[model samples]
Target: MSRYSKGISLLENLLFFWCGLSLILSIGGDNLVIPSWLQVAGRMHPLMLHFPIVLLLLAIALLWMKEESWRGFGKNLLLIGANFTGITVVAGLLLASEDYEGDALAWHKWLGVVSLGFSVFIYFFLDQVANLFRLAGSGLAVLILLTGHFGANLTHGEDFLFGPLMPKEDKMIALEEAEVFRDLVQPIFESKCIACHKEGKIKGELRMDHLEGLQKGGKSGPFILAGNLDESLLIQRIHLPMENEEHMPPKNKLQLTEEEIEILRLWVMSGASFEQKVMELPQEEPLFQLASNKFTTEKTYSFAAADEDEVKELNNFFRKVKPIFPGSPALEVAYFGASTFDASSLSDLKNIKEQVVKINLNRMPLENVDLSFLSDFQNLEEAQLNFTGLKSGQLEGLSKIQSLKSLAVSGNPFGEEGLENLKKLTQLKRLFIWQSGISESGREELKKALSTVQIDFGFDDKGIIYPLNSPKIDFDKVMFQGTTEVKITHPISSVEIRYTLDGTEPDSINSPVYKEAISLTKTSQIRAKAFAKGWIGSEETKTLLFREGMKPKSYKLTDEPHKSYKAKGATTLFDGVKGKANHTSGEWLGYTDSPLEIEIFLEKDQKPKAVELSLLLHEGAYIFPPETVEIWTGNAGTWSKVTIPPTPQSTKTEEIRYGLLAFDLPQGSFDQVKIKLKPIGKLPSWHQGAGSKGWVFVDEIVLN
Candidate 1:
């Protein structure tokens, strides 16, 4: 035999061997133990299969070419394509033994084997079946197309091939009729999860394709803890770092987005109800804003954005005017600092009347005349004038804005006359009259006139006294050289804010009522609450008042913080700005594997009586307070260690908390101080990441 003929014989023998090996592995199914080395080869099936597909297509085209001379070259191409096809079939069988199943995978696997069989058969009989050569080539081409179609579906997701041509179901569910789980939560799973956790391929033995399987769970536990996100196995897996072996979607697949994860959190927080509708929850619920995007078609405005200079000039510390979303032309204007809100605040917004689509004047001292300014905003779709001191017959001024769709007049004393005028706004779809002066009968009359409107007459009193929310405390600065003015405000006009300087809780009658901003000169623990005539008292809110003492001239960290959370370096500790409770807010310096050893130099003449280290506690994220805090005072390289009490145990739950660890110092004049904080070596037994390293996040250090 010729040299080329011998090489061709050897390749054909290898092809036969691969075809048999693929058959045996396919029969082995789940019983086969694929080694690590073989699994790596199997993963190359996706990349290698494409080469054989192109080779076969070209070989088939050459074989059927009208020219006779190319038929000889086509015979050699067919043999080479058939050899690679056999190799691909073997790799595919190995891949199938992994976490792959469902109808799409099954069809793709069988059709791939069939396509390889056809290529091998046609190449051997090319000369014997000359008349049938074209017929067999056509059949093999059809098989390749079908095999590729199913393979694409397996890799890309269901309906990937014909999804664009298929008739789509309308997904725009009305807010009143949208079910929480069916309309919102389930779709999230189908899109991001469910590939490996479906019926046939049950990774971790967990099936998330249906409700019952989710509740039943798999090897770990229940999919969700119902009202608890910390204990839920599914949430725990998702919150794991992307590089973690236990992270969901295997890090290689499409991972869940932040918005999708938030929807899951809302679902679990609201009892993971399967029967709850969107309208059944409170109208002001944060979930409604998220669900609105999913359930209804997003509104688009036709007007162009306002001039950048005009928008920038209008924005002040108290007033904000910006687009509803990024790059959107529609503007949502809001007025803050209610004490400075004047009548001109509404009139000043007319500079961008064409772009102003939403206005929020909630809790402002707005009068009836101020409502007339809204008439010129030709594109206004939403008006939040709740608690604006509007009275009866004032809403008539808003009827002229023909584009108004949502009107929130809640907390106003607008009775039948005010609601009667709202009937003239034919475009109005939602009317918020909660706690307004309108009676039930008057609301019925208006509802009949605007039959399609969704009227939210918030929480029917029904003689039930719901607890008020805690008063919001606003201060210019947390650390101050002189006295700082602390202002406490509540949204409702009738609600009273009572506060105390001591650590004791505030009561309705015993505590001093907050009429104006309170002046503070020293360190004090302030606890405040809200009370109304017919409502239960609100929970007490606590905060610390710090009088700045010796300021640090400079500071340095002996140990580096984690790369991801190293806030502006050591300067963050004495920048005079405190971080929020969220540890990821760039203001915090996070340490995971090392102790925080910081040395600070105070002014020469200043002597601090005590030192406070501000830290965050969020057990859900494995951020715990320091296990031990050591303080040493020194000057000119001479140091004296100060004895400190054992670090107090953290009283935090799943929620984020900002707390201080204060240490009193002995009477001495020390210019240099060293603080050492050791993070928890291992998480507590009750934590989700037990036996793993914990994190310590410190934002600022106060010397008083």
Candidate 2:
């Protein structure tokens, strides 16, 4: 024998030994106690697998190529390929001991062993069984292909090889034909929970992919109890706090959205039915509304996009111009900051007149502006000119805009004469003329003039006084650099919004009526209410505003915030973003048991006069005011502690509120500031979790 053949014989013997041992381990893999080190080795199987596939293909080609000269070379290559194949099988067997399970894994593993055995057999019997060697070589190739096919399915999911060529399934089902479980509940499980709890790789031995496995229960208990959310395992796991280890889909995985969880909860409450039709449920039920919204198709518009640079240029603090929905070519324009609006703002939009489908010039101080340009927007479908100081004559100019479908001229002084101009708009479908000095008799006449139009007169008071809804205040950051504008709006037309900036309640007769956005350059409290002729004023809406000072160069946290509420890390406090009452909105940094200690560095020229901590208070949620807050101001290593009064605790349960705690700093010019908040270590006696450690949630820290 040649020297190379002698080496091949030795490797062939080791291959035979490894193949036997790999088969034995794989057969008994179910009970094997795999260690961490072996798991690390098992993960290397993917990286080692390509070598055997490429070498085996080359070996078979060389041996069957009708060239005697290369037969010895092919034999040597076959032994090396067989040895690598044996090692790959061993690695795969070790991997099977982990979370991998299912029919795909089983088939892939056994087919790999068979391929290993076939390669070794072809190598040892090549010369003695020359006639069948060619056929065996072809058979070995088929085994390798089948093993690879199954392995791909195991890793990339079923139909990985030909999923694209298959017909795509439409996810949206009509409300009448949709089954409650198959259409709604099952999809939520497939997207969020099934990956870990499916047939082959069952975690906790629970299978959520189908109804039978879900009912069989897992190691924990029944997945769900019909008509009982309290005892259901699925409900309990999802409701657990995100910090808990047993939370479903895991904290690290894609957490279930609030709406998705609500769907699952509703499904369980409805006896977890598998064949219920969505439309069969009561129309007033929340589940029906959620399903209706899911299946409703959005309106599609056919129009080319506007120039990108022009859209960006037109969008500003006062005016917003963007696509109505993501990827849609149509655009919607809304103007804010009425004090800053001018005739040029409307004229400038002529750049992309064709793409503008909706224009909201609400409350834009447009009394004498030339709205003749509005007729140039040929595709305008909706126009909201509410409370824009529009006169009776301007309605004639709007009538020239032939494409108008929905028009709102509410809160203007125009009477029935102006309302008659809208009769020329043949395409008008809905008209809002509330509080326009047009009485019910005039509205009846206009509705008769345009029989097809739906005229909305808004809130016929009927001699009974109803309280108005509170005005919505729109301003994200409570702290501002130089000045901030706060806009207050009420949905009802012609209702007056009165406000006070000195923290006192606003009487409708005395307080200034809100028209434009309020500009603030100092710390102030704004209290507002809605007022009208026959309606009761709304409950007061209070907002605390602060003047920001000294932007932080950087900051560091002494202890980590809770994993679920870490809002953009150390920069969260100084990022000029504020969180609302909801703590889980990804804006607040929540800390429990530990003090929130932050060291902030400011610009060299900044001399902070005061410090403000924007915090949330919800006794029901176990979030309380800090016991005390300590602040120190200095640069370098010199520090002076500033004494502040203890923060008052909630004496009883109250609604969720966002409050500002301000402290005047000692007179100094300091670039470095350290703020430490000591959380109320334990909840007060009035709280439900009285003996447990409470939490303190902070959204923004202001230095002024």
Candidate 3:
């Protein structure tokens, strides 16, 4: 045989071998695992796929050519085309083995396989059967086109080419107008599940894009057994662990939120009815509340949309402008970063005043005069001035905004008189006056004047006449050398401050009332509480006082303090000053997700009577007293644990109080003392942030 002929025969044999291997792999693609090194090449199938397309088309064109020279070239072109098609099929199978499945994937796979088979036949036997070659060539062209279309759909998403041409409109309807099944349930399936279970991509042979398909069920049978969520396959798959193989939407797709899952559960449990309106559901039903909150339409205004250029120009880092909703013409303007707020900044929003339906200036540094521009926003429906400087007579211009439907002035010093000006805003529906100077009586009077408006005065204080406020401690240092007098005062002058020095919580009858400064000469744990008529007693405030002794010459910490709250170095522990209730004041050293270990060294050997550590406990902020505190004392290499304090029980309510863990040492001359404090590794179940690491805060450590 000639050298060229031998080379052609070798190439043909190689193509046939590859074509057979590709077909076998494609059949078992779902169970195959491509090696990590080959995975990258497999993923490149999409990028390298165009090569086979061009080669196949070139081979077909060459066959169609009337010229004898081009006809002769068709044989080599078919050989190249068959090899390209075989390799593409193999790459595609490797890519498909990695979690890719469904009807679309199968269709694309088999169609490509068929094209490969046709290419093989045409390459080897084109000369033997002319009519058969033409028929197979035409069939291969159609199969290639169909495979490419399905492949694009699987990679780029369904209807990628035709989706843009369809008319777009808001599919969401108001909760009042939405039906429980058609509007609420169907949309969720379409967004999260239908992509895999639709007609062409019916994974598990289950269809969800239509009601009839859902009723007909899939390979495993009916997804929903009416009125039974536990038996429903749809609910079961959604509730599965995200890492589970049977989990719906897969791990990478958008999973259902707790609320969305509950909505589906409630809908299925309610007989899985297809003709129920949301309003028709029982008012007390949980589904009714979820539907009302999720699907309710926002209030609409008839105002025109603001000029895009003007709105764009008014927006900056400190100022924001946006439409009220998806297709609404009304605009909402808000200001942030109070430090950058200027009085004249409000005037810049004048261009969109006619379209402005809401304005939020909460916590902004704008004065009363800056609010003068509010009168220009005649269409304003809602306004928030919470924590602003604007007070009483300053809101005269706000009264001109008759379209205002809701107003919030919480946390401001706006008194009862300031609220009277808002009575003229007859359109107002809700008012927030919490933390304002407006008292309970003032809120009642305002409610009577505006009979139709709902006035919110924040959470009910349970009608407590005088809710106990934190007591003020007048002593600078609870740990002093000789003696120090500490004075306690309550916020309300009429309330009596009672105290106990034995570490027991104070009571009205048992604890002595404080009349003047109490002088302390020795170490004591002072616990105090406020007592008043018709009110709950204040939280106990504990303080540790120590008689000063030899100061630690140097100290070393096992772990560095967190950078955010590293106080003035290790010496801050011996500074003799107590930190405020606020743990983030830079006075308290905070340790999170780790224990704190400290060793103190004295200038001379001395046997300290006791070692006192002051810690802050504010469970709401994830700050808890150390789970266990181990104290050790020794010289040089040998050390012995003096004591290990028991862990205190976690409290239910959030209370800010000081905790002192005291460890008494035995008679021994020790120069070095070590303290190991372990924090709560995970918060208790009662805590809102359960299963999360708790924080440990230490202000000062006293040695005497």
Q: Give the C-alpha miss distance for residue 324 in model 2, angstroms.
A: 9.5
Model 3, position 236, has a per-residue lDDT of: 89
* Model 3 C-alpha lDDT per residue in residues 161-238, reported as the tens digit of each score: 578998886654555567898877887887788777765456787888788888888788789888888789988899
Q: Please state the error at residue 410 of candidate 2 in Å.
A: 5.5
For model 1, give the 10-residue run with minimal summed lDDT: 293-302
Off by over 4 Å in 3: 1-202, 207-227, 235-473, 487-498, 513-517, 529-549, 602-604, 633-643, 649-657, 666-671, 685-692
Clashing residue pairs in candidate 2, if any?
609-704
Q: How high is each candidate's TM-score?
A: 0.44, 0.41, 0.51
Model 1, position 545, has a per-residue lDDT of: 62
Model 2 spans with C-alpha error above 4 angstroms? 1-122, 125-149, 155-266, 271-309, 315-332, 335-358, 362-457, 461-502, 506-609, 612-632, 635-661, 666-671, 674-704
lDDT of 1 by residue, 1-704 (tens): 99999999988887788778877877775688889899988888988998888889889989998677788788788888888888888888888877677787788888988898888888888878788878989999999999989887776666678889999765435455678888888888898888778754677778888888898887878888888999888789889999998898689888998988898888898788888987777867778667764553223456777887788788877888866533357888888878887776666777799999989889988765546767888889899988888875667768888888899888888777676576776678888878887788987887888898898888756877689998888887666667988989888878999999876789999899999989998766778999998888998787876666566888889999987578898988888777866564568899878899999888887788889887877776668888889999998868999999999765444566666678898787788999999998865544444445677898888888
| CA shift of 119, model 3, Å | 13
Candidate 3 lDDT (Cα, 0 to 1): 0.78
- lDDT head-to-head 1 vs 3, winner: 1
Ranking the candidates on TM-score from highest down gives 3, 1, 2
Measured by TM-score, the strongest candidate is 3
Q: In the order shown, what is each candidate's alpha-carbon RMSD?
A: 13.5, 14.1, 13.4
